[model samples]
Target: MKLRTVLGAALAAGLGWLLFAPTRVRPVAWEGPGLPPSRTSGPYADNGRLNTAELLAPVPGLKAPESVAVDAQGRLYSGFEGGAVVRFQPDGTAPEVFADTGGRPLGLRFHPDGNLLIADALRGLLRVGPEGSVQVLATGAEGVPFRFTDDLDVDRAGRFVYFTDASSRYGWPHELLDLLEHGGHGRVLRHDLHTGETVVLARGLNFPNGVTLGPDEAYLLVTETGTARVHRLWLAGERAGTLEVFADSLPGYPDNVRFDGAGTFWVALPSRRSPLLDAGARQPWLRRVIARIAERAHLPLPEESMLVALDLKGRPVAFAQGSGSASYSYITQVLPVGDALILSSLHGQTLARVPLAQVRP
Candidate 1:
């Protein structure tokens, strides 16, 4: 009888914890959609032939450089673990603080006039001048304050900028929580540099990550990471205000978007293809339980290095693969420079550079 009593009590406790755990996850029921079969496998695998660009090591190792931007003169810029935007010389020498966003900076692009624009995850939209002067451009859109400003791109006209707010509910150190929750609380915001008005161009996104202006400058593209697709919004012409899925069923979670001068945009996928993540997306309770388990277990994220280039029509053009045996970790963005591509990571100690010839067929 005492054993029976103990069993009943333990059952109640277990069920209670499952139903009412003090977890950061905000559970939402979602139908885990299918990810298209990865072409990254089989004979189609990109042989990944590029040189890893080195950087000044962060103190204690792994500062997590999430994004990269280069000046015309070849200076590279990326933010470190504590929200410091560090710039390195052309030869990866003379590391110095370019501008401290004080809030974590993710996406970076230089304006036509040589000012640097940043999408700060903690702050908002920002601009860094030549001498390291900093200014806040926008923080909220349509009265919604940004919780995760992830990436940005400037149009040819330079009058407006498009950026992604990864989540409106979850902030830093909790991005995975937002991803696991699968809530469509993300958004794409356009900040008018002239009028200083920030407006939401699209909403109900699933953890949007990187963003870029199309080469034509008539439309914008934002990567919806939670859904494994890119969302396109038309800014001008008759289709203005129209939103559609530019690309879908990607091999893995897409990070930043960058336009190669040769008419393609490069996207980085840090995660290797995982059937477990796909299966968990189908069950809300299962994911919540997994999240709770992860709080203690702290499972490691897969370190597959992948970069895909898509044309304006959202067709995959080129694929570049890195190694699981290599030192790169969670590559976040692939920035296009003249004749080469630069890679950054959210959990890597150095930047990488790959020759364009190897990335293209």
Candidate 2:
């Protein structure tokens, strides 16, 4: 009788904590892109193609090479978790420190003038000169400060820098909270390189994580991680200043996207969509309870790595994926340089590469 009473009291206290505990997440109820009926069908079929990925270079203490950029000379540059940007030769050897942002760097793009632009999660947009000098370009746009400067791309003429602010309410390590909240606090902004004018191109996006300029600089694409969708914002032509869906119902949460300078756009998906997250999208109260519970416990997330290749029109042409045991998982970006596909991850200790011919016909 005493044992039963103790169990009952413990259950009651747990329920009470779940119901009334304070949480920082302010969940909003919105429609979620429901999961596909079959995970092995359509554009999401697990073909195990990413199983062939191999580590590019393994530096002793380097971790989380989130984004990589290849210079005109084919040298690769990637940012590590410790705020160090390292450069590698074309063969992924001879590692050397390029610069340190003193913050987390997520996206990288090289300007026409040989400067590297970085979207730093903790320090905002920054630029690194050839001599390894770091400069803060813009921290925010309009009246709001950037809470999570996520990704960036520079125009061919180096006149503008396009970037994404992943969240205005949550930053860095709180991304899981932002995702659970389902609040639309993300936006895409453009900064004029000449005048230093920053303007919001699109607002109210749900975790706008990746930004890339489309062909001819006519349009730009940004990934909405919470909604599993990609949006195309027109930059020129008659549809300029408009937004439309570029891709929808992605199989996983997209992290970064890069154009191959040919005809394909490579999008890195760190993990597959979570059914539990989708179910909680419209239940704000339940999400609040879950959020409060998550504070004390670590919620499980998918661990597989997936990448999608889309044509100019956003149709899926190819897919590469690996199970949880795949060589390198949690891929954040897939950049095609020369004949090899360079891959980066936010949780991986080394960059990876796969032959381009092996992934394409």
Candidate 3:
């Protein structure tokens, strides 16, 4: 009789725990002031409007175009989540495979010596030689292996390469957890091929992704994807070796950043900022629970799609955005080619280029 009574009590307790235990869906209440708003004018100033007719729809079998780079011969290069570096020629020809990275390639840049520097999410930093040979430049930092190597930028000298490690916990497939945790796992690092040295230029970043060198090479700008801010690290002059916020209060989560010769910086916002993410940052415990539950369920959180252009002073010069409902979903990177802006997507099959002249300033 005692054994029966104990078993009943135990079952009751178990049922009670299942019914009343804290789930991962509680409301968040964070209230800190967000970063400053963007200072530049948007494309609306110039009367820009998206011309859907000009956009090139995806080829029959492409997938998840992430980052883009251009060569001197006017050839466009794009890295894909499917591990292919595809090239598009200026003559409106079909894109051909430049190389198969065998890992998610997020960022691509043409080195002065004709090699391609790739920030591969799964394979770490790689240098693709002119002959298409692959070499790993970096795999870890400070004895800790990289969980996500997101983007890269090569200096004019070609001796220095700067890149971002988006997170230490999540690679591309489960990036939503990084947003939920909001623990500042991102970092920016510089690799010097001439000296065979690697240095952490900045740390404690919030999902740092795209990187670009400023006009004078005086500083390098990095985008903090989770926080919607761009940070600058001075490489020369009085501010040498120091970091400062270049721009903030972005309309959405900033991804890959690129600088054009015409004094504009292009940024890709994969998704709009989620109110839930803002709320979760205030309640660490809630975030922790969400992370734990997310691990168990293998569910992905939501993200938005958009693109914006900013000048050197970190002000918005133009805004080109599309929601998930639109054809452009999860736009990850933008490259300004002549008067057109080349757009890359994280969840779409094709690459797109919109004419800047067609859009207002």
Candidate 4:
């Protein structure tokens, strides 16, 4: 009887380990090399005096504006979780239906040829013509289908489009899992219209949510949202195809990245840094268990709102933040247009544009 009891106990222990052990994720650690200290007290600090009066007035009839793209003609396009693209003219007129994407559209970028390219969570990479017709460019890579097609950027030549796949197991609804799991399920891919080829530029990325081309069009920057960092990929230099950390230790999890005309990159922080998440990142097993349970329960997690600005060389320049109290929601994307910054939220029903001059010196 003693032998049998000991064997049963051993089996139970093994089973528990199998069920609770954290999923093994590749360690993508940044030891502060080429990155500033996590905390700074200079111009980038939160002086608690950011003017958010403009953000109080929201766009009418928009829901969960994930991204905003502006064309050369000053026409603004916003993507929503309802799979609709709404066009807001420059005169603050009512928005009209630009296109019905039939899927959750996350990122919007206009090609040089007057076509709109979209990174859609359900439909994959798509192109919308001038007449509002849609076309699928690519859906899968390396024999694996995309699970969460998130953000994209178009090249100057209008022949290549670069985008991100945020996760393999979840769409936007379960992005918190990507954060807790810390597994490298995200990917950066390129689509070439001339060759009809889709290539995976970088793999094993953790929740790559936003993408943008550099000012010179020589490199691409992608946001690793789960890691609170942005990565750079050389596209034209001798180091072409090489990937490296562009910035790290962001104050919050970055959602979408865009560039301003002044050689600055603006990244939207959907949520503030959670100490619980940071601790889970240090311990793999706990994170996996939390992710599994959260997925099973289908519970909505908490997030914050923030926006950050960085220079061309990936140095933090400015930061504007809001409290996570129930009054405010998560900020998903930021676009710089003229003298205003258009902000998109994943949980709010309207888009917001805050005057740029108010947020910075």
For all predicted structures, in order, the TM-scores are 0.89, 0.97, 0.85, 0.85
| Prediction 1 TM-score vs. true | 0.89
lDDT of 2 by residue, 180-286 (tens): 88888999999998998999999998899988998999999998898888889999999999999999988889889999878899999897888888888888888
Cα lDDT computed for each candidate against the true fold: 0.80, 0.88, 0.76, 0.77
Which candidate has the highest TM-score of all? 2
List runs of model 3 lying over 4 Å from the truth: 1-48, 51-60, 296-304, 323-327
- Per-residue accuracy of model 4 over 1-361 as CA lDDT, tens digit each: 9999999999998778656655433333322212332434754455442335244234566688788888888888878777888887764356777887899988999999888999989989999988788898888888888889999998777888899989976676677767676668889999898987888999888789899899788899998877778899899879999999998888777889998757899998777676666765556656666655676677454465577888999987888765534323577888888888777788877667777876676
lDDT (Cα, tens digit) per residue for candidate 1, span 163-238: 9898999886577778788878899888889999998888888899998888677888888888788878898899
Model 3: per-residue lDDT, tens digit, 45-150? 2121442414454455668888888888988888776788888887435778888888989889999988999999999899987666789999888876788999
**Residue 316 in candidate 3, Cα distance off native in Å:** 1.4
What is the model-wide C-alpha lDDT for candidate 1?
A: 0.80
Q: Candidate 2: lDDT of 128?
A: 97
Quote the lDDT for 298 in model 1. 59
lDDT for position 132 in model 4: 83
